[model samples]
Target: MKIRCRSAVFAAMMLLLVLAPGVSRAGYDYVDISNPFLRKIPIAVPQFKSFSGTPEEMKRARSSSQLLAETLAFTGYFKILDPASFLFDPQKDGIVAPRINFKNWTTVGAELLITGGLVQTAGLVEMELRLYDTFKEKLLLGKRYKGALADQRRIIRRFCSEVIYKLTGHRGIFGSKIAFVSTTSGNKEIYTCDFDGYRPHKFTNNRSINLTPMWSSDGKWIAYTSYAKGNPDLYIKNVREKRGTVVARKGINISPCWVPGRFELSATLSFTGDQEIYLLTGRGKIIKKLTNNRGIDVSASWSPDGKKMAFVSKRSGTPQIYIKDIVTGRVRRLTYEGKHNTQPNWSPKGDRIAYTAIADGEINIRVIGVDGNGLIQLTEGQGDNESPSWSPDGSLIVFSTNREGPSRLYVMTSYGTDQRRLLEMPGEQSEPNWSPNIEGP
Candidate 1:
């Protein structure tokens, strides 16, 4: 979809006045904000002020600020300015309000500035963060967070989410997590880590092959296909409690996809001699059969509203993406350009669907509109890239690629920019699933 740009002259003038409380004049035009081809904002983040007396407390404060700056830069929305060339010292120029020297920031070519202070009280820590628009000299947002000393990462992520909300009217996905199948332990197991690829935790250790991990909408459970009992069966793992249960089906149980807002799921089962989609509850009771095609049907992804679904099927000559209407039992082909198109993941915004396409002898990532128009290729000129999954906000995509030798995970913007390696592990990794925004640590 295309969006019109606003007048540049008017946007420049809006930066000169003091914006109202809780209102932002950050010069972001929502009409064109969805366009991924725009330039990123330039932001400056100086060291946070420490109000503690001990050296250990001061060191913790500095590290906390650096973590926040790294998180913002990883979003691909802001270019962090180096502190060595800063014209003004945050300690001397002040951290908030009238004490800030807006001219000093503007002289350094920074459009936005972030300032904060950290202090230790008793056994806990308190932090205050603020975002400022340098040209207009306006405070875009201000908030305070209090928690234990070990909760600094969570606190900073919450504040960064607020800054994104003020600028783009949408919450950021910094606090989210990603789940994928990893062979780091010499076997394929389900593992999860933070969105920035830190602190990886193993979810399944059955010593057998596990594939296709899918998170529930509420972020409480993960459903995947495992071979723990010597059969290809579906199992759901409680994320918090670290417990697992088998779905207990007849044959070839795989590709489980949870409905948007309920405890039900749609998965592929081969009990009837052919792979087909079936709706089931969280506890493993079958609700109804979704597809009865003669060819193989698998990998079902639901739309945002839960009324429609996209899946891979071989009803035609080769495997391709197909869309099905739940209400009327109507099916239509959704991909035609490529001979092999699979792993279709509907975006959270319900505008586009991302999948894997085989072109020029390589598996590349591609996206197509809901109506099967505006097809765009995202990855090319390297090894295979497959299993595309969208972030909660539909602004980013995470997939696995073998372009760098061993298969490893990667993340990029929706428009295929800022593509970078996500994590470094020993063995091959694939089938990444981005989780929803988790509420707490």
Candidate 2:
């Protein structure tokens, strides 16, 4: 295939070409992510065949293939087959449909197969990837991409997104990001990383205490509470522009959560003597008070449709989660099993809420249905796990835990399986907020 480019100094635009014709998206029902007793599908990933014999081309071929497998395996849906047990050889066998041996893949119990090919010349890379169904001996998805050599990770992620959408009918989290607070520079500051905890960089250099970095519904802005000016204040800044508005009222301002599909957010502002949640515009203008109770109310999590909100309230003598109907102004307690239930995060599907619950001097993560039934504890006996946040698709939850050592970010399936650490840095990390699907560089 012929690859074209406009500029060498600037990053080249990736070109995608679909090789398959008239494939129905609904034809594949390999995964039902909502099922609790889900069995992982077995998939195989082999080294890509390099078209050029140069050492640089072979290095890219080996690394890109492994990166592809790692990206797909990060999702708890797949069991990547060992490359050492592969029967088909990329050096002698074909990476295309006509030349692939289906029996060789099926013999190793591979339900799905992926093959890749690489071509590099003059600092540009061209990749052709294909996904196959081993049993049916059919090509499920195929794409060709051409871009700069530096765009290897981005190119692989784009292909992985395509592969996930082909199987699950929903776009993957490869395009999303996670924001959290870290003490890497001897001060609490906000940092952003990719969904798989890659490319973590400091987002704020406030040189003071920063907490609860919340992403806007559009993913362009972040709101967090910083003590840079000597008081707990809410600062809303554009992620790329580094310009924002500050809500530096008389008292404390914290726990900012964005409303679904809107520019408004609910935050705990204590300009008054009492701590309560209030609705505010994107620019720090207060629209109205959302809660009014003698007990302290804060940490508001909105429903998917913005018709209701779930928050923490001490009105019932202890901190418990409560749900409020935004239309009729009716409040009802959602959690009664725990006295110290805080940090409630509503699911993207609006059917459940995940929160931090403290019981018997142990803090763990728990999820209960919206109707206050089916309470299940996710973490136990390891260490304190707090600040649970849901992925955009509601298939996974990211939280902070001190299970091994200092607090670090961890991700698990929605059903509380495949728990693993996401990233490690110089200091503790906490309060991870997952962002929505973003489309850009």
Please tell me which predicted candidate would have the highest lDDT against the true structure: 2
**Candidate 2 residue pairs in backbone clash:** none
Candidate 1 structure quality by residue, lDDT tens digits, 226-257:
99898899998889997766875678999999
What TM-score does candidate 2 reach? 0.97
Instruction: Give residue 54's lDDT in candidate 2 (0 to 100).
Output: 75
Per-residue lDDT, model 2, residue 157, is 90
Runs with alpha carbons beyond 4 Å of true place in candidate 1: 1-21, 24-31
Q: For every model shown, what is its TM-score relative to the native structure?
A: 0.92, 0.97
Reference-based TM-score, model 1: 0.92
Candidate 1 RMSD computed on C-alpha atoms after optimal superposition onto the true structure = 8.3
Model 2 deviation from the true structure expressed as Cα RMSD, one decimal place = 1.7
What is residue 97's positional error in candidate 1, in angstroms?
Answer: 2.4
